[model samples]
Target: MSRSLKFALLITLRGFSWYIRHVTKSFLGRGQVPVIDSDAHVVETERTWEFIDGNDIRFKPVLASARSEPNNYRWLVDDKLRRRAMLSDIDHLRPVDRNTQTPEDAREMSDIQSRLNHMDQLGIDVQVLHNTLFIEQVADRIEVDVAVCKAWNRWLADIWSKGNGRFRWSCVLPLTSINDALDQMRFAKDNGAVAVCMRPIESTRTLPDIYFYPIYEEAERLNMAIAVHIANGNSAVCDVLRSPYDPGASFGMFRAMTAVSCHSYMVSELPQKFPLLRWGFIEASAQWGPWVAHEARRRYEASGKVFPDNPFAEFRVYVTCQNDDDLDYIVGYVGEDNLLIGTDYGHFDPSSEIDAISILKSRTDLSTSLINKIVDFNPRNFYAI
Candidate 1:
């Protein structure tokens, strides 16, 4: 055979080999896959209590007041069914026990042992840990906000650093004040935090506006991605009243769907304002991506005169979808590059451990390279981890 014919044959053979390996691993389960869980939560400990203000009048009496009145946030949701749904269904899946476990034990279980066991079972190589209910569950508190955030970040840094490299942490910031948030971001970055974690809620006038450009500018300066996660906060209660019959079901379905569009709007505007800051919406399902992306494009195109800049330019938004979503439709519209596979795993359901890997392999269109990106590389790239 001539040299050119030999080269062509070699290229064809290489492509064939790539396809075979990819298929065998995905379908036949013949190859080892490195999984990366982009989203997971670690329960806080007494160390997390370090964030609480020992001196503040509101928090100083909380422990004693709890003994008398039990001022837990769970009590604020008055409706019994809604409260049960929030505590039983939602909290069950993502348990936050500030008692029971010591700081050392919490570290060993969540950061070290649980991750290792999960990786062994699910084939995950890394897990990114975010704050538990401290940020999301207790958002209504006005006094302990800054203190709780500081303590959370401190504990998070310690836990993440203890993991060596297997575990990564997204820093928690108090959006109650923009200057405080900026200071915390700098402190977090200096102390080895990869990303900042924020709840996806609108800001009030008393609090810093979400449009505070300085936070985005500082995040961009630090080369960090902001992880926006929506939880069953006070918003869940409002959702419950809106749909009384099956409140939990209605709220659960709509929160993730609504969060995508809300974040897309933020992504559209923030990027144009700062041009360098990247954002990722974590724990939100992938099903809404195509529609949200289409709407984003549509709205921008319709109001061309008012919005001259590309709405999605500064927004390198990565949607960390549930493992079981319609991967084909998601990958098709959003493209493989933008999707990250996040398993809100290791909570109550053991099935999450197994299903995480199965979900990735089930996607026929995903090549081994693309799978790798979704599993680990995408998160690392987005969060600078």
Candidate 2:
């Protein structure tokens, strides 16, 4: 055979081998236990933008190329860089096709049947979806942000409502205005939002502040869980609400915010204040719980300020983990009952895009029961689903 024919044959064999391997793994990953992904994000389609209704295309944040950079896209509003939206969901475990950018890229993130099929391939039983680009874009734009969030939530509900039971989602609250936030939240509950999502980074106000108390109260009353999914904190410039919308947080803020907020809630007796409230700090990983618990102990030793309850107690605290996190320490410090597993599906940069539970499911260091808790039972308990 000529060299060209040999090359063609080699490519065909490789393609066939990949298909066989993929099919086999997809079949094998269907687990007996349901895996609930506590924090999965979706790239919003133009369905979300439809609610904007002739707003200046420039001022309205939209996805655009990162100034000619290859394989990168950023959220830009009036030419100001907001955040890098995931341009692809290609799993790095395999060779990636970089030309996969399109609004249809969002179908894997937002479409009901597409996501369900992806979940089956990954061994995930259910995924709790959160908003992607817009959450950070609207962080500081106030009323403008409110409109964007309102549109996005409506679009989200319309799609997830059709998901049967496979897709559950939290709505993004209009955090800039109290009235707006409350109104949209009611709308969210009516539309079937299971929780409310906020970025863990310090917003115009830190989450534990009294300004957020009312939101927390309403969430508690509505039986809506609160989720603080991680964001870069670089994108937010919260202009509404109060005067000191702290702009101090950066990419490194999620871990610090998780520690600080939980500590504050415990120290200031927030768990008691909003006793029925539930919170999850997600995508920040689960490694910090022990350190924060130790600091709480240190402060207690130094100042004798005793918390009415352990902040790490199962009722008030939940944190999401990657397979690489020290699961043993997390369970020891925060309790296995409080853990949540987030595949971060479709978040291409750091997310495992495929088989989010395979690591824990296959871990020799963990017991089958502990694996089950992290992948299945714990998330259900956290979400009360």
Candidate 3:
């Protein structure tokens, strides 16, 4: 059958399995319970999976211009980079539809239905939505960029606002101009954005470029944390992987890995100059945290004395760790305060919010207090929720 029908069938099967597990756990009294503390008792449910799946939804924005480029796929080649610059192509990367509905129209409902079913199976609370590949779409446009940003932001608020207070959002900004970006930040805050998202590629300039200070200031003013993320194959690093010298290698496998290294370098430098700015690197994976911290510290110790104006002074940058053991090392280096959890769920990954929570709880070396901080507290503290 078609992709849409396949997804629908999968959702139905997953939902049925989830109901069985939910009833079985409640009947056997094998449900997870809340931990009590001096301040409050945290209650978990056997039906927690159902609640999480039912409540949490994913929102992905599409940029209409990113998919139109002739050399879009070939842009991965180094020689083609010059050709891409000359073409100045822009188009939206359309999502694959399994049915007659447009991807944008169907993505939220489909993702919510699938995610809710998975959440019921996994016992998660909720998931905040983010865009798929809009970052790459807006990277090159300077003129009329604000309009494109507004279009995506308005669509997200309109479609996902019915989720009561459970649905959260990451807003898109027009970074071509600092003034325009500041206005967009205000617009996003008024429209219920939980965080502001941008690419880490420095397409216009480095994150610390003085031109963007007003944008950072606006984010801090609105109490929304800045999230720097990367769409696959949007940077020069991806070109290195697609080189003829390594034709057998897959481009998709190395995109995030390469972007994470580039992002670490950018993060190490941005915070020192904008010390008040709270930032998180999303979709960059949790494993790189310790190395980033170690490298930043090493470089600072070696040259910090010589360059007193450096931005890496006692820096405390926050990062979202995917459920993994590398988080154990990241927390050891950055401390519990700097780590948060994100499953990058609601996509191909069937793991739900509960699965992420279980992973967090499974860290026996970590205290209940620490787990609570990672699961709920850190995000609230960072986003000022």
Colliding residue pairs in candidate 1: 51-147, 271-314
lDDT of 3 by residue, 70-122 (tens): 35432221112221221112223212321111122123343445434444454
> What CA root-mean-square deviation does each model show from the true structure?
9.8, 13.7, 14.4
- Candidate closest to the true structure, highest lDDT: 2
Give the lDDT of residue 280 in candidate 3.
Answer: 64
TM-score of each: 0.70, 0.77, 0.62
Runs with alpha carbons beyond 4 Å of true place in candidate 3: 1-107, 110-122, 232-240, 243-272, 306-314, 349-354, 362-365
Report, for every candidate in turn, its global Cα lDDT versus the true structure: 0.55, 0.64, 0.49
Model 2 regions more than 4 Å off? 1-31, 53-59, 65-72, 88-111, 134-139, 232-251, 307-310, 351-353
User: Which candidate tops TM-score?
Assistant: 2
Ranking by lDDT: 2, 1, 3
Error of 2 at 135 (Å): 5.7
- Model 2's lDDT to the true fold? 0.64
How well is each residue in 1-385 modelled by candidate 1, as lDDT tens digits?
7542353344346434533543224534655544567776665433445545456424421222234534332322112211211121233343242211122333334346655654556566667777555333444454455665676677677666666456667887666566788888988888767677765543322112455567767877787777776543345544554565763553453355346545454435555565555567766666777677666666766877353232222255677766557777777666666678655553332113335655576667668887876875566566655
Which residue runs does candidate 1 get wrong by more than 4 Å?
1-34, 50-111, 134-143, 205-211, 232-244, 249-254, 257-268, 305-314, 348-354, 362-365
What does candidate 1 score in Cα RMSD to the true structure?
Answer: 9.8
